[model samples]
Target: MSDTAPTSVVDQVLAAVSELLPEIAASAAERDRTRSLPRYVLDLLSSAGAFSVTVPTTHGGPGGGAAVAFEVTRLLATADPNVAQIPQSHFVYLRLAELAGSASLLDELFGAVLTGERVANAQSERTGRTVTDQTTRMRLVDGATVVDGRKFYCTGSLTADWIAVLGRDEDDVEQVGFVRAGTSGLTIVDDWTGMGQRTTASGTITFEGVRVDPSHVVPRQRAVTGPHGYGAFAQGLHAAIDVGIARGALTEAAAFVRSSTRPWFEADVERAEQDPLLVQRFGELEVDVRAAESALVVAGAAVDAIASAPPSRVDDVAREASLQVAAAKVLGDRAALAVTSALFELGSTRSSDDGLNLHRHWRNARTHTLHDPVRWKLQHLGRWSVAGTPPPRGPQF
Candidate 1:
């Protein structure tokens, strides 16, 4: 947990998340096998107010900040990584609205989300190469924009009621838009079947002459640069997922070591936990987990400070917040990998029905970290710090 003032609402959120762990774990295998998120789980999350944390109180939302969101995500991830990640892409767009001070948009978008309407990201493409080159083009036609393009890795597409899409304008600058699900000329092609997070239902979304009203276009008058952007929020959430993976791995390993009796006893050892090396390994993983979590706290504080600042200080604050986000992601990602690997090795189970999904933790951690590897991102941050050059722009944050 981050060392900040704990709100009752945050505690309520944690309680809601904690209560879902059993259901999440129970459904993990089914979700992976089916390659789809169960509708019931999503309904449960909506009713719990999970998606309303970023929206303002005046708008009938929880009015929470990035840190509270991080905690909720981490808790959910401890049980099911796929389900935990499903809400992040939508919440990221909501956070963007908050940063932009687009309260009207937030009210409309979040009201729908609070009623179980899922949202997804239609940004990443097979050949969209950079943020500047949006392969998807939206052209003005009569009173609306006609969209034609293919978006890849559209997580939660199976359940989303709307998708926030990025397209190229006449000037080739990237702009964001929203299209309601089940709209004409829209198609969702199921394509995701990865080794991990298969339940995310991440696939390809196609828009062929999909008509979007002018009001649906997310304006880009202000260049989203400097600080106070998506990067800060993403780092905090990614770090939380990393830490959650570690915690899950450790918990599984600890339970296995404590109960599973083995026959490879040297003298009088009855279980793997009796081994000195296993004990030492557990301690090492615990230390790494704690360290990574602490780094996340520091990063969260940096993000909160920047988010609370006046509009004039946003750009510089965003840049500084970027560094902290990178640091947290790098450290937390490494710790998750380490702890999960150690847990697998410590567990001496040979059967697949050991009632422990050790490999899933590592697989989820490995796959999700690719969203933006902390190592490369850290180098970018260092480059900005040393060269005093503007950091490269990415699709999110």
Candidate 2:
């Protein structure tokens, strides 16, 4: 695909996000210090239509597609990673709803999304030795579906209007059931103490016989496979987050070197920016960032194309999209880690200021990048390239 300027709804949304970066950056430190949700920032993003980036235009959303959503996510991550992460699952759930939900169900959820309501995911559980294994159960009880289980890494649940709980039905079929945020028997706990992305509210959520509407339950398999390329789209969002983190790190590095950093005594350069070694390091970092950005853009376009294609070709398109996204993920992970860690090298003492909290960038990158192992992503990509193998149909790829 040819690289062109972003236009239409994508351009509009990206412009809006760019305008909010200053304010988002201003509050980022405080939010990180307190590990509190940036509700004000989230409200601003919602008003700017950030949450509606991927919702269908027919459903009163911008309908900017996967590429547009990826751009928005990358911009948001640059300003505040915690806030950026809050909506990752929201997009995934919305895509799944569009792919598998019934007409009435889609209308209801999409309408809520357009009105600034958010959906949180309660999918990961500690009981499962493997990521795909689930102990959570959703069974029909007296004409109503009841969900009973505990969930960990339930990102964005604390502030969401609705929760999408992933579980297996009586027949062990994977399914997702939506429940209102404050429904009876539903509990959201802000207990996450991770080293990075602290404000994401990725904690434990408990559902003790929480009742779910029958219409709200959708088969996960249907959405995971279809013409939408939902898995690739989801992975693209993650890659965007990593790219944003890298960009943020590089931006900070440039500012500090030009203004506050001192040149090495032996080199005798007037400014840190003039130091040849530092300049070379910056050049190297910039190349890495640009390469990751290019990869993400291409992968995102592939996902968008697959999403818009006919269902007959979805399987083939999804495989290709998955391989592309896997490659992007690897690049994004390396770029973010390198840039964040390298920032400290410019001026270690000054960068260590308690208030600046520069280390948080590395912390966030290190923590969030561990969401999935990059080695496996590389393995999959290598397998695809050398052996003509396709990645398995799952969310992580």
| The best candidate in terms of lDDT | 2
Off by over 4 Å in 1: 1-7, 34-36, 101-104, 130-132, 220-223, 261-264, 310-316, 349-357, 384-397
- What does candidate 1's lDDT look like per residue over 100-177, in tens digits? 535556678877866767778887877745534568998899989888999888988888888888888777766677
State TM-scores per candidate: 0.89, 0.96
RMSD in angstroms, all models? 3.7, 3.0
Q: How accurate is candidate 2 locally (lDDT)?
A: 0.88
Clashes of 1: 3
